[model samples]
Target: MAAQASGDLSLVGISKEFETFTAVHPLDLEVPAGSFFALLGPSGCGKTTTLRMVAGLEEPTTGKILIGDQDITDTKAFRRNVNTVFQSYALFPHMTVLENVAFGLKRRGDKDAVAKAKESLELVQLGAVAKKKPAQLSGGMQQRVALARAIVNRPDVLLLDEPLGALDLKLRRQMQIELKRIQSEVGLTFIHVTHDQEEAMTMADSIAVMNAGRIEQQGDPASLYEHPKSVFVANFLGQSNLLRASIEGPGAEGTVMVSSHGQRLEADASHIPEGAREIWLGVRPEKLRLGEGGGPNRLHGVVADASFTGVATQYLVRLPWDQEITVVQQNDGSARALEGENVTVSWASHHGFVLDAAEPADAGLGHEDG
Candidate 1:
């Protein structure tokens, strides 16, 4: 883990409440200097609230906010060296792009506000539209203007609350690359909040998955997806097929035998509890291999449905236990499985992960359907 001491921003035991409702529970997070970190969750998970607190738009009910080792828990929004780009872009309707970008500097009475704004506009490749009003620009262009406005001040931290939410999918993806390039050039800490898992995974150096006003797990995108700590994180971060299993006995090489729906399998016990009686085995859809001739962890299933997604083909397999498992295969221009065909689903023991027994009863598995 990267040390928090090296970060430009740190939140320690932060919490926020509104009257009878707790908007955010105690949360601790660190944003490494010059790193792009994402706070990802579903709606009402308090990601936006956390960002607001960091931007000084909301006061925390408890805990300290630090910027480069200095406590700024009580600092006013303007006094703290942080800027935010809101979801709506929030540009002044009457102001031209140039004036909007220069607004913050003008408030600070900076003599070079206009020059700085022009330079920032150039940075976002929007210099040609500097004199145009917000209404005159396309949604993507308006978003760029908003970004230029935020970065013109060169704040220590830039908080982006779903700045791409309003854009169409294709434009959003294009902006994702642009945002990453800008972050690299500025070398400033970026704390972006969004409920879009794909966006977070595409842009963030690390991500914190939040749920129900609390952070369920935090890690690099790969780790979080491959080894989710709880059921919520597993399901929310990406699609996962979880199997309920009970430990049968010890096996070779620190592996354990488990039984699921009358099928016996072996899996690595390195991360599971020593005396784990029950466990949820989680495997990504793409990890499962089709056909027979699997090494150790293999099962037979009938293909229920298959869909071609251009780049990949997704298979819905039905197991003997009446559970449906999803499997995805890259489209390599080769013959693939057909619907209603019997195939064996297999994955290496090391390719999957097992949650500890101490986790919630529903951990590592979503709601089971009848």
Candidate 2:
């Protein structure tokens, strides 16, 4: 096993290419040391390729990989102090939990292998399962075992490749918390790769949203969700009701006035693309309220569909322009609208965002649901 080294992961112009096409484009990124960072994108978006390059499994076609100030571009996979926990877990069925976790440490002839493995298992809350075989454990437990195996090595960076993907939703959410806790306790930098938006936002301290083998945006989860600079980032990170609008210049309190579907709407001026007159007025489903709720921005629409999802009611409002927008209202026993009723959707000026209309509004739609 490799020894520990505390260092930020820097990918300077890092890229990957295959015989047919480039898997990853020239990329520059810095994953802060001891932060939970996520490479979030759809399948085949080159996130996995980028992760493999950092683990020294895939040689980069260009640029260098560094841990802190040390250049590890030429290092071998086994020599780099980076460990990967994959979705498959891959624990040996024949070995006990402790044996599985201790295998790597023992292979390196570490004298405290058992003790280290025990501590790692306990860190993952699996200390009691040390004597149990892999087959006796649940899927989530198996995932934890795999994590313990990697953590025992004390790698400077822990790479999780959809490690919780195999479990059910409830279990997966549970593991997200566990993973974050383990990372906090261990204080090791974690680079997680997954396509699930919620998974990345829930566990990551910072997120890099990737598309077409390139970084579209990178920031804290709330910043990316609230102030998305690109249409793809706005739509892909969360559900957005983007309506084509023509900017009517500035508004009061630094907001932008825009006209859409014969109605005037206001958006955050700071979110408006610089010098972009034509824009898409964007609002989240949760940001909209049914009926005229005293917000500056309002749209008259027919309730095309409504679905009750326990605590919230999701309404699909069909605007006069024949476009459908979603509105999620809390079930607080208020007078909710029916499917066929005509209503006005209203939201605060600050709740709306603006994106460049030059790009397709539907961009990142298919990838998000898949």
Candidate 3:
């Protein structure tokens, strides 16, 4: 048995429901102390609802919310040892950075409110801007001020609700790195909620991919991406080319052989669920190699489209089954396939994953391609 987590955030059978809508199903999750955890999914996936329950903003219809061993299900929002930083920044325009950071400490009647706030500001590298009002700071600076304000309280768990959504693409990336650095320095448990796959994978120590009020999968970013158990996870977390196939018994070295459009493909047997006859073969776009090159699995297709994307080139290949698959190859200035050209795609067996076809495959896939 796994050791019981201490000083960590744990949700036990927590769930939420409206009059007729079940926003969140029963969920049991644990965020390890001092680790960066993320609740990742698209809009209305109940990720935010789950966060709200933990924050004590929304009471769960059933079960308990615990910080370590203390049950906080009925605790008031203000009484819980948690803080949330939202995307809006929500800094007071009239208050200087120091005052904003000191607000929580002042309310709690801390004698060293100003000193503690200043230290928090320095923690976020914003002590130089202590005298500036929120209006005088840039968007990113304002964000930092908001962060300083939250962390100044030294909460057990810090909740971030799309905290970088307001920033531009470049600034968002910068904040992702900055947030990870700050989380490490403080050794605080951070539960970040975001819809962006890159943001979750880049910053979180573990990620829970929520969909339709349930957690489809939860694990370290690399494990979830490399060995997704569900089709939704395979496509939602990253780009995947899913091919319909049927199991044809075992192949060399304990690998499973599956047939797709009269072509045999080999995949790691462990990825094929027991007793699953028909499955969707999954391979990441970057995993595929163009022009065969004697790889284990091969598929011939016509290049429907091709585009150079600086570091890599993307090709849309239409297979014989009329499914369009994406292939990405590094731009080494090598020979490239043109539109309407016939090309062979291949990849090593281990790179492939198999998912049960009976499971729903339409859970928020193809957003990038669309």
Q: Best candidate, TM-score-wise?
A: 2
- Reference-based lDDT, each prediction: 0.86, 0.91, 0.90
Order by TM-score, highest first: 2, 3, 1
List model 2 lDDT by residue over 31-60, tens digit each: 989899999988888999999999999999
The alpha-carbon deviation from the true structure for residue 51 of candidate 3, after best TM-score superposition, in angstroms, is: 0.7
TM-score of 3: 0.96
Residue pairs clashing, model 2? none
TM-score of each model, in listed order: 0.92, 0.97, 0.96
Point out the worst 10-residue segment of candidate 2 by lDDT. Answer: 1-10
Question: What is the descending lDDT order?
Answer: 2, 3, 1
Model 3 bad stretches (over 4 Å): 1-6, 366-370
- Give residue 185's error in model 2 in angstroms: 1.1
The residue pairs found clashing in candidate 1 are: 231-364
Residue 369 local lDDT, model 1:
12
The reply for model 1, stretches above 4 Å from the true place, is 1-7, 273-275, 293-295, 356-370
What is the alpha-carbon RMSD of candidate 1 to the true structure? 3.7
What tens-digit string does per-residue lDDT give for candidate 1 at 1-370? 1112234798999999999899999988888888999999877889999999998889999999998878989999989888899879888999999999999899989999999999899989999988889999999999999898888878788899999999999999999999988888777788899888889989999999888799999999999988888878878777888888888888888788888888998888785655668888778898888864445799898999999999999999999988999999889887799999999999888778886545563442342210
Clashing residue pairs in candidate 3 (N, C-alpha, C atoms within 3 angstroms): none
Residue 268 CA displacement from its true place in model 2, Å: 1.3
lDDT of 3 at 158: 92
Error of 2 at 213 (Å): 0.7
